[model samples]
Target: MNKDLADIFGNLVNRIVSFAHLAFDGRIPEGGAPGETELRLAHDLEQRIKALHRHHTALEFRAGAATTRAIWDAANAYQQHTAPWTAIKSDPARAAVITRVGLNLVALCATLGWSIVPNLSERVLGAFGCNNAVPRWPTGPLLPLLNSGAGTPVARLGLPVEKISSEKVAHLTARFGA
Candidate 1:
């Protein structure tokens, strides 16, 4: 069950941050600032996760399981519903938008998924330029770390993730439910 959620988040951070790294030609930004459209998408995602977090925090044993699943589901839905990558060649202006959204999405995941996978989330946050800060629950529209003074932006995103094996699937099927 743990691996099930980790795999979803791992794949999401890897793919999205990979795209964000390439979109800027490997140069992130001075203060890890992503573009406007990216920020908007990230803010929207944060809102969804925060909503789920509010609902699950009251439960004891299943406190974060539902929130983790919600984040996973939301990430998958975003990948399926939007093709931000299509803009690279078709519309140069749109490329920035895609990059911002992708990078910020990674940031959002880090903030919201900290409880589920703290170390992995920290890596994703580091890739986005937040080094020492912890993510606050019920996150607001703006990311404090991204806008603050911190780590240098890179041309290539460095997300450290471990892939989940197929054997983990059998263990997870029994646990996933609403």
Candidate 2:
């Protein structure tokens, strides 16, 4: 409803799109392979995701924007803290773990986001190699991972959005409550 909220959605879409594109694109550095740290991080992230799900469910029942705020905050935090780009080059192995966890995190968010924006969520799911149905929460390490080894290659994944337009920001901010 507001510019800050719009900014959050815009950023979440961008981050998810980037993760999937880079992973299946065969652009990852050779040294990166999913490992122990990844496992730990995945478990922690799963808990966070479940909590988000529960919160979302509760609000819809009691009858809210609560979940949106929580997810956007989580997505932004993960995006900032987990620098998959840097890890891919510096520590490929760690990068693998980092990227996977981050991707899964985004997948979880997208699944939750699907109901609100079916088209966008569908594209997000397809990118993650899913056909239909929201993926079960607390997914495994590789549940939604990009399988570069799968069949023939397709068109390279391009970014849906790079930055929010000033027009969009102004439009969104103006629509917010006075």
Clash counts for the predictions, in order: 5, 3
Q: After superposition, how far is residue 112 of candidate 1 from its true place, in Å?
A: 0.7
Best by lDDT: 1
lDDT of 1 by residue, 8-123 (tens): 77777667567655665544333223456445655766676666666656654365666666766676566545555676677655555444544555566677777667887777
Model 1 shows how many backbone clashes?
Answer: 5
**Alpha-carbon RMSD to native, per candidate:** 5.6, 5.0
Question: Which candidate number maximizes TM-score?
Answer: 1
TM-score quality measure for candidate 1: 0.66
For residues 81-173, what per-residue lDDT tens digits would candidate 2 score against the true structure?
767777667766666655555555555666766656556556756765676766554445433352222332222235533457888768877
Q: Give all TM-scores, in the order shown.
A: 0.66, 0.60
**Pairs clashing in candidate 2?**
32-92, 32-93, 33-93
Which ranges of candidate 1 are over 4 A from the true structure?
A: 28-47, 59-63, 142-159, 164-178
